[model samples]
Target chain A: MKKLRMSKATGINFLTYALVIIAFVVLQVMGNQGMLSSTLKGQLVPICAYVVMALSLNLTVGILGELSLGHAGFMSVGAFAGAVANVALSVSVPDTGLRLALSMIIAAIFAAIAGVLIGIPVLRLNGDYLAIVTLAFGEIIKSIINNTYIGMDVDGLHASFVQNTLKLEAGGRMILNGPMGIPGIQKTSTFVAGFVLVMVALVIIFNLVGSRSGRAIMALRDNRIAAESVGINVTKYKMMAFVTSAALAGAAGALFAQGQNTIVASKFDFNTSILILVFVVLGGLGRMWGSIIAAAALTVLPEMLREFADYRMLVYAIVLILVMLITNNPAIKNFFESTMGRIKSGKKAKGGAEA
Target chain B: MLAFLNHVINGISLGSVYAIIALGYTMVYGIAKMLNFAHGDVIMVGAYICFFAVASYGLHPILGVLLAMLVCTILGMVIERLAYKPLRQAPSLAVLITAIGMSYFLQNSAQLMWGTNQKMFPAIFGKTPFSFGGITISVTTVVTIIACVVIMLALTWFTGNTKMGKAMRACSEDKAAAQLMGINVNTTISITFAIGSALAAVAGVLLCSAYPNLVPTTGSMPGIKAFTAAVFGGIGSIPGALLGGVLLGVIEIMAKAYISTQLSDAIVFAVLIIVLLVKPTGLLGKKIREKV
Candidate 1:
């Protein structure tokens, strides 16, 4: 009986992986055939990035029970580092595939380093204080990026590195260019690339959750004192969770920067952080699959509602309130549980009688 | 030297505004043990109320301010009744999320109603500068300082001397015990929200008058800054909120003047991380030991 149950679980896992791979191939073929619109293709990269961000943040907030408002700050670091790598490598290596791979690896490494740097100091603080501190860090990083001058010499014009890098022709222009935004990024965000990244991220997170370290993190979430008493280093584990989350968020940011033709410092502001947080919370905390679904759904929903731009945020606000209300209501939870219980009991009875 | 002094004065004026707003945060957190993220949006609402009264109804700015305060107080009570009351027994995380939701709801609703365009606030005090000892000061700055001081004094008096204030103190110290002692927990909580919201409203009006550009998203930055101030002072301590706000404002301004203005936020957060590492309970906060 136990063997049968194990086989069934393995079968389900195999089916899930097969379906995901098939979807990836189908999407890639569609992209190659020019079936998907340019606008839809343009959005795919950020959506994938958001999925990674939301999933990773779930590790800290949902599983580890920590509120981090500075996820985007780490992302900013990753984006700049990634952009820099891509720029430098594209100049040196003539091969596009090799350059892309190298840039991603560089982005991931720098983002992970940034994560550790931030996590070491702030992970000890718990609850809302943690949230506020992270938020401040995010804002500070954005402001610095906005003010700092970047430039390179092209022809006779001494183009600011930032402007030239963003494809702005420098004549001492205030281009993103002074808050106008960075344009002309290489559109390397293919559906297959995004799908593979998501699959890898999902697998890593899943394995981590199943591993001893993940259990230890969850133990801390369940009961910090009990976990500590059992010789678990709560602070270290929390820091680990935060750093891992930050690295994932950074990776997502790098993907976002490269995918979009235009990137702006203002786009990664406090509201952006809050929006990502909403994805994590709305998806059901501590549940990885829920976050993935929520990320995809929420990303698509706003774009679908673009016609009602003014009402979009208002609707978002309402959905947030409604989601909280429904989730927290005991009656709704009980109703769903009872229905599932009835179905399970009926199946058990039928199987028993047949046996 | 004079320029430095002038900057200091400007910092104090801004700091006082932050202090007033921070008090609302600290007070609500002290009693409810919930971070009222909507408190900042309540300030935005208050500013709009004043704007409508001044622009639409043509009321005097002072009267508009008073009306806004009253409306904000009532709105606070309603929010507590509708959004927070149900989650009183829920986990801290639930309430925090709910507050965030409420904040987004409030801001977006305001946007939907008022449109996203920046609205101009009528200047209550004339934009005349007063100079003394080679330092120049705006009339609005002086008014802002006086207004903050008066509000602080009034809050102190209300919380110290009034019956409702005593009940609030009782509730914060020990909710169950306060209930046992015949203090109505719900009423006290509602009143706390009301008073806190009123203070936020006053700060909102002041901010609008000084800055004169209002948008739906404007409350977010100020809200965040005030939240930091609250933590810096001590989350549950009122006077600590004031001290933290003043200190934060000064540090931010000085950082902008001396260090790169871009580094101001980074420096402020660095201070927060350092302070939290050393003193988690905050500057004026008494260390709390949870009864396991």
Candidate 2:
């Protein structure tokens, strides 16, 4: 009887995966046939990127129980690293596929390095202090990007190494026109690429959570002293979670930079970090599936409400407060639990209690 | 030497404002153990209140300042009752996030109500300068310094001597014990927020008068900086917040002067990182063991 129940559950999980795959394929086909609007197609890249960011951030915030506001700093580092790699590789190879793959790897590696550098000192601090330090780190990175000078000056327009590195010679300089942002890069991002990335991220995160290391991290979140007494290396697990989340965020940042026709430093400001954080919190922390749904829903919500531009953020703030109130209310939680309990009991009674 | 003196004056003035704002952060954190992220926005709200009082009602700047403080005190109490009281027993993170949500709500509401365009704060000092020895100081700077010191002294006196202030101190030390001893925790918490927010209002008025530029997001930078000051001085230590604020302001000014102006924020954060690494409890914070 237990085996039969297990088989039924497995079948349901497989069906869910199959449906997701089918939906993705349909969307891709529609997009390629120009059945979908370009605006939505353009938005797809960011939506995918935000999903990676939100999920990765959940590792630290939701799983490891740490508040990190400097995720954007890591993303900025990754974006720049990826842009440079793409530019350099194009100059040397001039091939599309190899450059895309290599740049993503390079971006991930560089972002991970930055993650370790920041995590060493920041992870030592707890709570609001950690949050403030991370926030400062993000702001500092922005300030540096704004002030630093790099690459060529052509007709009063200055280009950076990222833009110029790809060109065979003088053309490379045309790529990153400094603060003007890199333009005209190949839009290699497709529905397949995004879907594959999301699937891989989900699989890795799921497997990690199911593993001993993931359990250790979650245990640390529940009770740090108890976890420590149980011989869990609290610091090691926290750092691992932080670095893993940073790497994922970095990968997302690379995709975001490469996917867009134009990129600017200002786009990845403190506000962007806060927006990503909103996704993690509003989704209900520690719930992976909830985060994914929240990310997609919030991403699409703003676009749908674009006509009410002035009231958009105001409404978002209201919704955020409302969600927090509703989710944390004990009365609401009890109501849902009791209703679900009754339904389950009714089904059990109808099916026969002998099973 | 002259450049150093100039930086010193600039630092002290900035520090004075930071110290005033940091008091709000430290006070609220002391009693509730919750970081009031909206405290800075409250400062912004205070500034706007004063702006309306001066611009719309045609009141004197002094009267405007008092009115702003009064309004902020009431708003602070309302926030405590509406948002914070319910989350008293929730985990620290819940209250922290709620504070952040409130911050965002207040900022966006300000933008929606006042519009996003920057408003000019009228300069009350009228280009007056006071010279002492070889150095010259703006009248606004002198006034701000004097105001900060006077308020600090008044607060110290109030907290040390007054009945309600003593009750607040007792509550901060132990909420349940204080409640058992017949001190009303709810009223004490509300009063703490009121006093803290009123101090923020004073800082806001001084900030606007000195800079004369106001925007909805103006509170964020100063807010973060003041929070940093609060942490640097020690999260719950009032005098430590003052010292830390002064030190932070001086460091920032010096960094802007000696190093690249762009790197001032970076340098301040680096100091924070170093401080946290060396002493995680901040400069004056007492180490306490957490109970499992």
Candidate 3:
């Protein structure tokens, strides 16, 4: 029975991922046939990026039981770092595919480095304090990005705090114009690239949660003292979860940057972090597929409601609260669960009768 | 040196405002055991109320302040009852997310009502600079410092002396045990929100007055900063909040003054990271031993 239950859990997880893949395939086919609207087509890449972010954040918030409001910071770092690298390489390597793969790798490396740098200090704290530090870290990254000056040239990369401090070569170009940020970034991010990233994020998140290290992280989350007493390396596991989450967020950031024409530091503020958190929570904690669905739906929902421009965010806020209510309120949860169960059973009965 | 002294005074006044807001954070965390992420938005609501009352209704500044506090007190209680009260037993993350949602809800609604443009919130304290011993101080700054000190003293007394305050402390110590002892945990929680909201109002007014720019997003940075302050001093501790707020304010001002203005916020956050790394419990936060 225990073995059966374990398999059942895995089955449900697999089923959710399968549903996501089916949806993506349908969307891709529809797009190829010119059935999807332009607005939705534009949103597809973003949906993928946000899904990666939400899934990555789940590693920390859901499984590891820590709140990180700075996931967007890691994303911004990845975006800028990846964009700069690609911009410099644009002169050397004109191949979009090569740049795409290269930038993603470089971006992930930079973001993971930042994650380790930040996670080491931050993971030492607990609960709300950790959340605040992560938030501050996100804001700090934004400020730094806003103040940063990066200019590229045949001589080499020129970086400085002062905007005019870097004297570029006669033919060299300014990659990041400080507060103006990276303008005209090469748009190489496609649905296919985004899909691979989503898959990468999903694989890491799912396998980690299923692994022994993942269980140790979750154990530490539930009761730190007990886990510590049980000889779990609490710090190591926590850092592992945090750095992994940051790295994925960075990868998503790189993809998102490549998809955009202009990227600014202000784009990755505290609100962005909160927006991703909303995705994780609405999706259901520790539910990877739920996060992917929530992230994709929420990303598209706002654009879908573009007709109600003023009321869009208001409606979004209301829906967020309502989702929270249904998920948390026992009365609502039970009612919804019963309704879902009935529909499923009703379908099963129909199939049985037909057979 | 005199300029530095003036900045120090300014920093203290700024810190005092933060301390008031941080007190709200600490109190709510102490009693409710959850971070009221909307605490900052409540401050924004209060500032807007005061702004409308004084700017539109032509009410006296003191009366305007009182009205704002009254409305915020009610708003705090209402929010606690409607949203947080139901999730008493839910996980901390849910409550935190709901608070975030509540914050955005308030911000978006305010933007819809007031628009996203900055409003020149009238400084309740008259425009006058007090100069003595080669130093200049704004009336608003002096007023803010005095007001914050008074509020802090009053809060200390209320929590340390009053019967309801004692009940709140007891509830914070152990909710189930306090209930078993016949304390009305619900009322205590409501009172905690009410008091915290009222403090947020004071902090909001002074912050707007000092900074002199009011927008829907105004309360967010300060709110986060105050939360940082609450943590810096030690979560759930009043003196910790005050001390943390002051130190954070001073650090921010000094960093901005001596270092790059662009990196001041980052520096402040870095300080918080360092402080937390050095002492995870914060300056005054007690280390609670977890039981399995």
Candidate 4:
């Protein structure tokens, strides 16, 4: 029975990943065939980045059962870290692809370090306090960055919170100029790169989820006291999930920076964090494929509904309310289950049940 | 000394607005187990209503204020019934998400209705500064402080003396037990939302008058600040909220005065973290053992 259960879990996961690959390949083929619009083409790279962001957020919010309102802070950290590294390394690395890849690694490393530092104090708190602290941390990071200045030169990178503190060499590249932010970055991120990163994110997340630590993390989420009684190290597991989530978010941020020239700290504020949270929640928490679909759809939906620009957010709000109502209402839930159950039974009875 | 006194007075007035808004957060949190994330947007909604009443309809400013409060009270009740009522038995996460959705809905709808352009909020009170002991105070500030004190006193009395208030108190303590004792828990909860929202309306008017920038997004920052006050004072405590709100206001004003204006927000959050680290339950919150 245990063996069968494990196989079923793997089968479900395989199907989900297969769906992502098929969708990605089909989109790629469509782009190559010149069937896709310029607008749609522009969105492809961002869709991948957002999907990765949603996936990382799901690890913390869904799997870990912690509402982190600072996922975007990690993203901001990654974006700036990667961008700074790129500027600092521009003189020697003629290969934009190599620079982008290297920056992404640096971004993920920095984000992971940040996650560990933040998670240590933050994971010790829970519920609303945790939510608020995460929010404050995001705001604090943004505020600090808003006051920061960084310049790169042959002498190396110079950073300062106060003015006139950094003496730079001739031909020094200014990566961050306080509130003005980093601009004129080389756009090296391609749809292919985003797709590869998504695959990487999916592998790390799925592998982690299948592992023992993942079970322990979810166990603690399910029942903290019960999990503690069963000898689970609550803080350690929570920190693991948070740090991994931060690392993945950093990678996504790096991809995002490569896709765009300008990256501002304000772009990754509480609102951005909440928007990502919406994707995670709307997709159904802890569901990997659901988040992929949700992240892609919601990002596209705003752009597609641009014709009815005034009513777009209004419609989005209505949809948000409706989804929550439908999902939470017992009567609505019962109806879906009954109808779905009937459809399944009508199909190849036992096989349908297994599927 | 006079400059310091001026800052203190200014802080107190600002704090009064936060205190009133914090009261709503505390009251709702005390009764309902979920944070009403939409409470902040409710302030925005109230401000818009008042702005339209005075600017568009040319109503008396006092009437406009009253109208905003009444409308917000009803809006709060309707929101409670429609958005929150169905999810009472649902997990806390669902409820929290729903509240966030409701807040978003309110904010965007307001944006759609009222253009994103900043509408001018009229000065209801005369723009005259009263000077005493080398310190100057705006009439609006004095009125705001008076209104806050009056409302706080009235609320304290109502909760202490009135039958419905007692019922609310009971409901907050134990909803199931309150219902078992023949108290209408739903009504109590609805009333709590109404009062909270009404307070938000009062705060909305005061906030806009002080800053006079009528934007759809105005309520969010103050709402968040007030929530921090509610947490600082103790989430479920009334007087705790008052004290927390006032203290937060003073700190924020002082920080802006003496520290980097851009970093004052960070300073406020830092203070909250420090407070939480020292006392997780907040200043006035009673400790409750979590059951497995």
Fnat by candidate, in order = 0.52, 0.44, 0.64, 0.52
* DockQ score of the complex predicted as candidate 1: 0.51
Top model by DockQ, which number? 4
Name model 4 segments beyond 4 Å from true: A162-164, A342-355
B-chain TM-score of model 2: 0.97
RMSD of each: 4.0, 4.2, 2.0, 2.4
Please list the C-alpha lDDT of all candidates, in the order they appear. 0.80, 0.80, 0.90, 0.89
**What's the distance in Å from true for residue A94, model 3?**
1.7
Better of 1 and 4 by DockQ: 4
Categorize the docking of model 4.
Answer: medium
- Provide the TM-score of chain A alone for each candidate, in the order shown: 0.81, 0.82, 0.94, 0.94
Indicate the TM-score of model 1. 0.89
- Model 1 clash pairs are A150-A161, A150-A162, A151-A160, A151-A161, A152-A161, A174-A177, A174-A178, A175-A178
Model 2 residue runs over 4 Å out of place are A1-23, A29-37, A93-97, A152-186, A331-355, B290-292
Candidate 3, what DockQ?
0.66
Chain A of candidate 3 gets a TM-score of 0.94
lDDT tens digits by residue: candidate 2, A270-296 = 778877887888776876656676787
Q: Best by lDDT, which number?
A: 3
The residue pairs that clash in candidate 4, if any, are none
lDDT of 3 at A23: 82
Candidate 3, residues B1-292, lDDT tens digits: the string is: 9999988998898899999999999999998889899999999999999999999999999999999999999999998988888788787878888888788888999999999999999978999899999999999999988988898899889989999999999999999999999999999999999999998998889999988798998999899999999999999999999899999999989998999888889999989988888888899999877666
